[model samples]
Target: MADAPQEIEALIDMMARLPGLGPRSARRAVLHLIARRGQLLAPLAQAMQAVAETARECLNCGNIATADICPICASEARANGELCVVEDVADLWAMERAGVFRGRYHVLGGTLSALDSIGPEELRIPRLLDRIEAENITEVILALNATVDGQTTAHYIADALEGRVRVSSLAQGVPVGGELDYLDDGTITAALRARKTL
Candidate 1:
């Protein structure tokens, strides 16, 4: 890094800041990109520029989009009267990657946290409530993470919409590949509570 040009060092530092990348990995990546500048670096730069210029949050759902409304929000087929609430755009993307959920989504940006001073007003809760009425949503499926803040946010949303619409949450429990011995107490408890007759 000491021998490298200032601009190259700066690029490495920037890449190192990305999630899952360390300084060593970033240095290697920068070297690789420099070696293949014509084939990879130029194209990557163009693509990044394009995305930076066009990407925006969907007006209705808060999903990342290149337009005012994301494709899911604009599609008539996705209006299934079910809204899946999530803690972030990453969560929404994860749900989409699974291809199991078919309805539209509402990204909350983040969970409520008293320590962080984050409340319902800080997220998209008010927008979510508005969408429930505007879209004639029949059910809201909370897909938040199992963290304490996530659960707290879910409870708050549930209580807020108690009588207005049917509200539910994704089941919490031990994962399919998890063993009882390896599972935590809370996971075991949730699994037992959610056990079925089958």
Candidate 2:
């Protein structure tokens, strides 16, 4: 509006909606992108467009993938009879970045919450139960956050999967109310190593 081009303004607005980015940072980022249009902006635009069209939830796991089944779900090497359940895709990516767990992943999309009206039906809980038997999963590791909602969700899943598979959770190393994405690789590794049965 203030003498800025409509396209640039729109880009800034969209960037501002990204997590952890504010209007001020979005404006600066847009300006930097425009300055490096040929090298950065154009390619980034293309990549975003491509992902927007192709990105979808994996059928087996709830992880985002370009295909129906994510690479991790499709890989035989990852079918280690252990499944780590995370509350979000970012948490799954964080676990992958740590490179400590060799098993598959099950993304719950979100935690159950009565205040927000979210429930098991909304968070892929039923699908997870079906997957346990279908995939012959031996162990389920709850890598949910330390928040109240996160712990509640973990307990729900542990109860649901009891007797079907050995269920465990990330140990005390994870800070209270902390999300996995905020934890360092070493902490993730240590927590995973010290995981206790739920």
RMSD of each: 1.1, 5.8
Cα lDDT tens digits, model 1, 1-198, are: 489999999999999999999999999999999999999999999999999999999999999999999999999899999999999999999999999999999999999999999989999999999998999999999999998999999999999999999999998888878889988898899889988898
Local lDDT at 51 for model 2: 97
Which predicted model would earn the best TM-score? 1
List ranges where model 1 is wrong by over 4 Å: none
Q: What local lDDT score does residue 189 receive in model 2, on the 0 to 100 scale?
A: 85
lDDT of each: 0.95, 0.92
Quote the positional error of residue 124 for candidate 1 in Å.
0.5
Residues 56-144 of candidate 2: C-alpha lDDT, one tens digit per residue: 99998999999999999999999889999999999999999999999999999999999999999999899999988888899999999
